[model samples]
Target chain A: MATTVESPGIRREWQRFTPRQRLIRYAFYLVAVAALIQSINSVDIIPEFLEDAPAQIVDLFARMWPVDWAYYPKTVHAALIETLHIATLGTVLALIMAVPVALMVATNITRWPALRLLGKFILVSSRSVNSLVWALLFVAVFGPGGLAGTLAIAFRSVGFVGKLLAEALEEAHKGPVEALTATGAPWLSLMLKAYWPQVQPSFWSIALFRWDINIRESAVLGLVGAGGIGMALDDALNLLYWDQVALTLLTIFSVVIAAEIIVTYIRSKII
Target chain B: MSTAASQPVAATRQNPFPVNWGARLGWVALVAYSFYAASLFELTWERFVVGLDNGAKFIGRMLPPLLGKWDLLSKGLLESLEISIIATVIGVAVAMPIGLLAARNLMPAWVTWPTRGLIAMCRSFHPVIVAILFVKAVGFGALAGIMALIVASIGFIAKLFAEAIEEISLKQVEAVRATGAGFGNVLIMAVQPQVLARFIGFSTYQLDSNLRNSTMVGIVGGGGIGSTLFTAFQRFDYDFVLTILICIISMIMIGEIVSGWVRKAFQ
Candidate 1:
């Protein structure tokens, strides 16, 4: 005769049906409703705000029309170049700085535990703040320009690339690395012969992806006085030159599309 | 595998990295150019030393973040929370269809190309830049900020979603299709299960990011605590700035904890 015993899955189901699960579920539902209620109150959409809002909307659109198309050629070239410069330099430098740091950070790659902890700390601190915050800090310290913008992008890229590369490194197959080591290859040779090949495709794609993000970010660094297309756009807005604003938007939109095409083509080649 | 002494460096470099003088020179030039670029940027110790005092002063001002205007800050914070939630919910909801259409493996080139292009254009902008555009288009307010972030949310989540769809186990999808199931049915039965966790994960991440961004967008007059923070900065209310920073940091950390809890519950 078998003793009365519940299977693990049945035991789990029984636990879910217990009073504790029911209480937790109910509590969760209550909190969600409360949050939704809070949102409704905060927006203050009780008809008064909506009434005046429509007129403002109409006025805004009227002002937006008849955009100054002529402003495009003058503004696009210089600002676009600066933005590209910042992004390209940032990505290249980041790739350079990231490799050794990633190797050091990865638990499997870096045998020494202490060094790994230090690398992780470095990555966390660098990544903790957003790039805009970094731009703000650098702007205050170094006076605002493309240099500050580049630094902000580069520092953030380091954190991003290092963390991602380390994870990829950790997930790489160990057999090849061990084989190279067993054959008395030097550490550098082991990396070049074994590890890099496996991770290169992913690394290239991530780098290109970051480059696209950095370009967009670089454009906006000017808001903090860090310099780029953003500065010109900021000037246009402040002056209430709606036409110029429209022109700027069109330029940025077109350039961004072009960039996306380039990145897609490059990614296809690499992948 | 020869002895280290017997093996020629030429053999190792031959296939992948040609040992031509041109390649070696290219490597040398790259290293030299990098160092040259660094120096041109004026990243000097002297400048850093001079800035320390100013930095200290700035930090000092940010102290005891004055919560004197508690009502204003609390109200703004609430609005920000709403904007983030609404944007995440709507954006993620819309991304489902668009992402489905854009995945190359799932859709034909005609459908994928245009959808992909739209996502790319959306992705190509920072929320702040997008906010500025929306402000110009729709006028400055919470609405502009909301619209901007919604576009941002779509740009990111949909692309990741499309990639996720592309990476799904086609075997399962094919099996469902083999059962004479329509596209929608195959997606529901096979694709959704594989990608549900990632979609949830992306949405949570987007929400967290949106919360942080919601604050910044207000600096450009997009509405939320950022507007208040900008005012404080402009008024030279350094202490208030400090207070706002503390509040923002706490808010984000709380968001992280809450999102983590949500994920845990769902899983």
Candidate 2:
């Protein structure tokens, strides 16, 4: 047995981070600070406008007060309905399109690496381009309308739904799959009997979640002439109709909250 | 015994696959609604076929992407990058204290309630809408874009950060308190360590989103590549539009890589 050292002879202390970690952290901070300084320097901010911001905000809000409640029944109602239609229809379209992509992406379902990569490429391209960008493109090709908005929402949502659905598919339990395979079930039968039941709850949940997001997205697609409430908002803004703008904003806020509530309630029941 | 067993089997022999009535009804309603909505939009198959024809031509035109306007493209890209970085930095910095105050586990109900309300209001509006307001207020440019993105980052990061803080182990805080540490000390030592990695993760995610948004905010005159893109679209410069899209996608992919690296490094 070795003898223990005397306590007074040795120095003991505590260190929160190693030298390497501390260096790395300091370097990160340095880069961030540098980037911030450079960005601030490059951004063209007029001193006058910066100073006048508070006054400008106060003036804007002053114009927005006493919202145009009467404007709702006149124009906003139809636009609001259109927005909901676009959201729901687009979500359904996306669900239909995403299922195949999700199947291609899921490793457990599609054993080929090349197909999975292709699936990933589709998803990434769809997601990287913002919904508004997609709307802009669709509007150009389709001559602008709710059709364009619906297509944009569907295209944008495919990536999100496909990604999540693929993950859920991958996480399906192997026991049922093996059992079905041992019973000489075909691929389609295996998928339906083994994987579908396991992922059904998550599939519905993901659909609801995407629908909630689609509502907010479709509400703004009209700014690009794709159709919906944003068209009214765009019109009001151009006309300098602050009251109407305010009313539209309020309508959108309420719709978003309502969608959130509905989704949450449905998800709780289903999941 | 055999007769009794047979009777039990007969009684138990119900439908092997019972149908869900509610689900059936839901499907029917969904289908009916789809038809009605499609009719309202006039989204007929003929329209789709014509649009598909246009789309094919559009894709054909986009094949030879115009790379001639490097200067204009670079300028817009730089502006977008600047807006994203500035917005992300300011947003994350401002969100820190707000997130701390909004954490129900750390703060009183009164503090959390108001802070959470503010966060909700922030999150309710789309960034483009907020950008329009900022453009009007600030008279358009990168500043408006930056401000809009900052608001977005704050809304997203603060709520997530607050949730993270709330989920942290309270025992660490108790231990720090038992050591006669001040509130600030306790927060720095006990709270910061636990949440720092997650905070970094959230900030990086916000940065990625901010970058994506910055490119589009210019369409509303918020000063970025979006205005240029909108102009190109209006001018029917399909090739240039394709180039811009490609650039945006590549930049986003790069940002994803960088953010993933940062997350790994921090972890």
Candidate 3:
């Protein structure tokens, strides 16, 4: 089973590296270890921060005696609806924005290499940032509300969907596209007739997948004042209302699970 | 005039392909909607101009970053790094086994379904939300942060790694199993070799992600640099805030490099 394949020169050179090179690497590791040890020996200022925690924890949990069964009903109604709406809107918006750009970013689709590079650059920079960072930035601009949450979630979704779809497009079966092009079809026609159909399933599944993530993300955007159940959760925590916190956590967990199941069902049906 | 009239007939005869009217119309609609949406978002010239000035002022205030508070800075950095590393290790270790067990192509329905559900549950919340829950559950500080990130890590890495596993070549696996090898033996010899390089890639990527996330988990009082950075912002200590931001970016970039190196070495 040991089949002999020709070793490319670059790989051969890599395999022939000397021991001196290895020793230098070990020296670098030693320095890193020393610096790490110095950092660890630094005093824990964390104790000062935790000094007030005992009182806060006690006070926070004190009011949790009888569960707020009435408040639970309210949470189930309004807050649940808002979280779903935000996630749905964000998914719709991101899909709309991602499709065309994903086509442009796909290396095989875009005839002009420069355009593909620029599109990929835009996608990379956009996606490198996490959704929470985007939420914080939008909160500053849009002022704490659902709009900010929507924009933040949608912005990140664009990046996620775009990158994934672009990759799908890249990995598509080339035979159909080549055949279409050989028949003197226009570039757009080649893509529409060949590339789109092959990659569409993956794109659909990824979008459905994003929906599951977005629901959870939308729940927390409220913590940063972007508006949702998170705002309620934040308030409950600050005031040390464990019963309310418990209620919010329960709602989020169930909604997220339900959303996940629905998404799983949809992706299965679609793909 | 007669030649010009004849030219129209020649052009029509030469160019026989009919334009796709529906697609053209769709493109037009997309452009119009994008413009309308931009307007609705107030992404106007005036806003852009004012925003530039405001950003300049913010940058100006942050120009001279205060490194004088080395003690606090160093402590926070170390804590954040520890939180990230610990989370990455625990998260990846937990995720790898579960991810393998959850791969639809390899595992039975009963095992795959539950594992997939567990991953989805873990992944549902953003790290910050998870951190909030953990803080409430375990009490505040580094412990909460670690737990939150561990959950987040499991959710993300497991789902993706499982997908990677599921997408791998069944032919190669079948070839190994054809030699009358046991399931464990086949997985070790056949499955692991096919997926190991990619799994390493995923693990390193997760570590890099955990580093970035670790910085923010503290914003919810989970622990690390986020709480420190948040406090500095609230106090309008712009210089200190800038310093922290710079340090975070640098640390993340370094983490990215380290992750890359790890992947290269393992591969």
For candidate 2, give fnat to 2 decimals. Answer: 0.76
Off by over 4 Å in 2: A1-19, B1-16
Look at candidate 2 and tell me the lDDT of residue A138. Answer: 94
lDDT of 2 at B174: 99
Global CA lDDT computed for model 3: 0.77
Top model number, TM-score: 2
Worst 10 residues of 1 chain B by lDDT: B10-19
Local distance difference test values of all predictions, in order = 0.79, 0.92, 0.77
- What ordering of candidates by lDDT runs from best to worst? 2, 1, 3
Report lDDT (Cα) of residue A126, candidate 1. 70
lDDT of 3 by residue, A1-271 (tens): 2344456653322333367655654664574456445434542335544565567556646756455656666654566666666676777788888888898988777889888888777676566666766676666555567667777888888878999998999999989988888899997788777887798799779878898889988898877777778877777778877788777877888888888789889887877
For candidate 3, lDDT tens digit of each residue in B1-267? 587596876554544345779868966985776555455445568866665676577678877998888788877877888887677777888999999989999899999999988997787677887787667656678877887889988998999889988888999888988899999898898888788778778877887888888888888998888888778866768789778877887888788887787666655
Task: List clash counts for every candidate, in order.
Answer: 0, 1, 0
Q: Candidate 3: give the TM-score of chain A.
A: 0.78
Lowest lDDT block of 10, candidate 2 chain B: B9-18
For model 3, what is the alpha-carbon lDDT of residue A136? 67
Q: Write the per-residue lDDT of candidate 2 for residues A1-271, one digit (tens) a residue.
A: 1344446779545576778888888888898899999989888888888788999999999999989999999999999999999999999999999999999999998999999999999988889989999999999889889999999999999999999999999999999999999989999989888998899999999999999999998988999999999999999999999999999999999999899899999998887
TM-score to true structure, per model? 0.80, 0.95, 0.70
